[model samples]
Target: MLYAILAYHVEEEVASWTPEEDATVMRDLNKVHGRLNELGRLGPAARLGATEGACVLRGPRKGVVTDGPFTESKEQLLGFYILDCADRDAAISAARDLRQVNPSAMYEIRPVKLYLPGVPFPRTEDGVDA
Candidate 1:
């Protein structure tokens, strides 16, 4: 099965949710998650905290260090799901369903590349890496 990542861009200040509302959303999402699980398509899914909670380390010496996201965009990543699907269309269909649960958010569906030892990377129709 092919894998796809479903990422969401959440408004910085709008990512927070009241405890009550959070519980409600979780209940709804769990229903969908259960359906995916039954289909043997769910891989992983989780909600991330604020960008400020992230730490970046770079270089061999790890001299380059940063807090939160590097961009100045108004939206930051809130969470994501990695799903096993048959194709991009299936991934998009899943994402569209997710959007209905979080209409105010934006989602990006990206295919996950898999590299196995001793096997050449898959190539696209145009000769680009798949």
Candidate 2:
């Protein structure tokens, strides 16, 4: 089965990190990613931008567009990882590996019912995972 590992953290806390601190976390996470990739269990990963530049469309048809990441939770979703695992336990294990490096963050793992990955889009930059 395929699972989505959602990464969440307090925006202020993450935004407070130095460049080096952020890089360290990414490096360690990439190590786990490498192992999973080697096992052919990893899929497309993403790092979302801050809510400051985000918008939300609510209600009917061409709904009203609003600002910010408006979840009721304190922690905002900052990133995600897609993994192919044998079972729920395996999916949780993958999230655990991610949490080991970034202990302060939280993860929510959910099974993927369907994945429709479309044709590749043009690359703008050699940016981070997303």
Candidate 3:
């Protein structure tokens, strides 16, 4: 199964880190990433730009666009990783490893629902998995 691990951290806290501290954190995280890559579990990953440059688009009919990272919380989405895991437990284990490296942030693991070409849409009736 494919899982998306979303990394969230306080923008101020991350931006305030010293250069050495940032490098050390990244080094530790990269160690974990290297292992995952060797195991063929790592997929697409990226570090997002600062939230200040972000824009939100809403209202499909009106196509209204607004500038902001998100309206809900202070913590900004820092990064994400697409991991191929055997199951939910494996994905959680992978997230745990990341949490160890960066203890100040939160990671959200979600299964990816891929829309493949020529595939029938997943049934949404009767509270079934979709």
Q: Pick by TM-score: which candidate is best?
A: 2
C-alpha lDDT of residue 19 in model 1 = 65
Cα lDDT over the full model 1: 0.69
- What is the lDDT ranking, best to worst? 2, 3, 1
Off by over 4 Å in 3: 115-130
Evaluate model 3: give its TM-score.
0.85
Minimal lDDT window, size 10, model 2: 121-130
| TM-score for each of the candidates | 0.74, 0.91, 0.85
lDDT of 3 by residue, 1-130 (tens): 9999999999899999998998898899989999999999998776777788799888779788999766577788989999999999999999999999999999999999992336555534222545
Alpha carbon lDDT at 75, candidate 2: 97
Superposed model 1: Cα runs more than 4 Å off: 11-16, 59-63, 115-130
Best by lDDT: 2
Better of 2 and 3 by TM-score: 2
Candidate 2 lDDT at 106 equals 98
Residue-wise C-alpha lDDT for candidate 1, range 1-130, written one tens digit per residue: 5555555565543546776776776677778778888989876565665677687776676478778566665666777777888888898888877777767677878877772435544433212435
Candidates' C-alpha lDDT: 0.69, 0.89, 0.87
